[model samples]
Target: MNTRTLIASALALGFLAACSKPEPVVEAPRPVVVFTLASAQVAPAALYTGEVRARYESDLAFRIGGKIVERRVDVGAVVKPGQLLARLDPADAGLNAEAARAQLAAAENEFAYARAEVLRYRDLVAKNFVSRSVLDAKETAFRSATARVEQARAQASVAGRQAGYTSLLADQPGVITAVGAEVGQVVKDSAVVMKLARDGEREVLIAVPESRIGELKKAGRVEVRLWTQPDVALAGRVREIAPSADAATRTYAVRVSIVDPLPALQLGMTANVVLADAAASAGGLLVPITAVFEHGGASAVWVMQAEGELVKPVLRKVTVRQYREDGALISAGLTAGETIAAAGVNKIIAGQALRPVAPARPAAAPMAVRPGAAS
Candidate 1:
């Protein structure tokens, strides 16, 4: 054990210790979340925003002009057929009717006196006591009296109708939606006094783009969801499609009749309509909108694939039929039960190996709030 030997050993030990400091642990790549294409028997749909409206709305008007003396109903008041809704002052009408009746009675008495005079004249003429000119004059007088009586009767009938016109009545059962006049307000002939929404049926009216109108008509049926009650879906049929497009919007009007009574649904409520076709049901796939990517004026998606000892992603082209808030409907270049990257899609490229990731669970549906109930 010499001093030289000890110094050499100590230097060698120090060199080994410096060179062999434990290597830092290498970390594995972070895992990505992806969704697998699923084969869901979804009823294909096309959604539209619309409004609930009554099937028939009637505007009630006065047949004759007069000051409104009374209004018997207000907005939201329920009325039945032939129910009195309002009335004008009948004073003038009553006076007119009385005048016509008095004139008619006087004309009847005159007619009776004329008939007796003609008979007396005829008997005198037969006895040669009266001249032929006098008999002729008596006959003419009787005919004129009869004509006056007929004219009086017609005047009486006109007066009766005018009196009846003072009272306004409902022609059908309905809810009063509006009152256009107030008490003491002078209204013109045929002026609208009230608005009524008729019973029996209700409908949803929507405006759809002209380009989509043809497809909608071909689809045939749609599902309606009220904005107030998103969870409750009601069935509707395509009742009408306007032939002309609106000048400003370039969209056509579509009316959908609600098949069943939705008591909770009311007039003026907003609605969402879903339109579907057979092609959508048979061969299309729906994916979250975020998963779709654009490239060279075409739509593409990042799909996860397997590679030896590594996980990567590849971009594949697809055809987008339509876009939805939560997802998109793909017409081509994708299949059910295949995995695709939903997030971090931009970082992926063609033919890259990728490890499959779990799809995100769908969000829970919100609870429905009934009308007049606390939200």
Candidate 2:
């Protein structure tokens, strides 16, 4: 009884132990798209909409306010220096000029009388016929009269200038782009009467976002093209950059001065500005668009690490400078020669061990054998 029982218990225990040990768990390596990090010549190109404008634009305004009596030219009229653009009533200015002339004449007569009085005072003092104090009094009177005459002369000069200011004349050769006043319109002093685009260097004005302003400033080259003529690419340089961003648009105004502008390049035409910068293209790591994913509201990607013969995926937080159709420009949080997951990011698991296998090649077609040629 003892031998049979022992033998049966031993066999049963062995069978149970074998069944409890689960078959070695085996998992197939998950396939993911991986990209090796490498330095690439990234030509950064940014497109901005711009308007062609005169480099030196002037807003012609009236120095003296008056009722606009007539306008000589319409918008877009070319004018030479000293050409009359418009005029005021002029009757008031003419009256002022005449009054100034009358004052001048009166001052001259007073000056002549002062000179005669001074001569008489000098002669009386020399002859001792009049007391010294009497001569001194006449001399003081003559000096006071002379000061008044000089003041009157200055007043007349200014009045004469104001009379001429009633006529709005072009200070330089230019094309009129705007007229702010019509006939019978009363304008304030220094108010803009006409907008003029001086004939000279042309420029393209663009609004650049705050994010790209730094890159724009550091750009090595700039190019411009008109919307009508795409092939007419012209070279340009940064002529002006706004010191501060616009409060409304939060963009900086940029002016690109054209070099050797063509005669056909006119003001008010739409232009395209392209900035080519080497700052982003010189030294940075670029990954595929799919490689980046959002983590904790920050940018991150799965980096592949070589673990002996196997590959392991580790999460890396990255600072993304810019994103384009091709990929994202990584400003920080990555190093050269790093491998990152290019696709299938959602299927990834933390600390997952993986085997890096090259993408499988297309299977070679089986060679067809001649019918019954060989066994």
Clashing pairs in 2: none
Q: Over the stretch 1-375, how does candidate 2's per-residue lDDT look in tens digits?
A: 699999999999999998896789789776666777754332345568899999889999888989999899999899999999999988888899889889888988988888898899889889998889987887888888889888888988988998888999999898999988899999988999999999899999999988778777786558898988886788888888999999998899999999878788888999988775343443345567788999889999999988887778999999887674336767788876778787777778878877665435522111111222211
Model 2 / residue 280 / CA error / Å = 9.1
Those runs of model 1 whose alpha carbons end farther than 4 Å from true positions after fitting are: 1-42, 131-137, 212-221, 247-250, 282-318, 322-375
TM-score of each: 0.65, 0.65
lDDT of predicted model 2: 0.80
Candidate 2: which stretches are off by over 4 Å?
Answer: 1-44, 277-375
- Give me candidate 2's TM-score against the actual structure: 0.65
What is the C-alpha lDDT profile of model 1 across 56-158, one tens digit per residue? Answer: 9999988788999999999989899999999998898889999999999999999999999999999999999989999999999999999999999999999
Give the Cα lDDT of each candidate. Answer: 0.80, 0.80
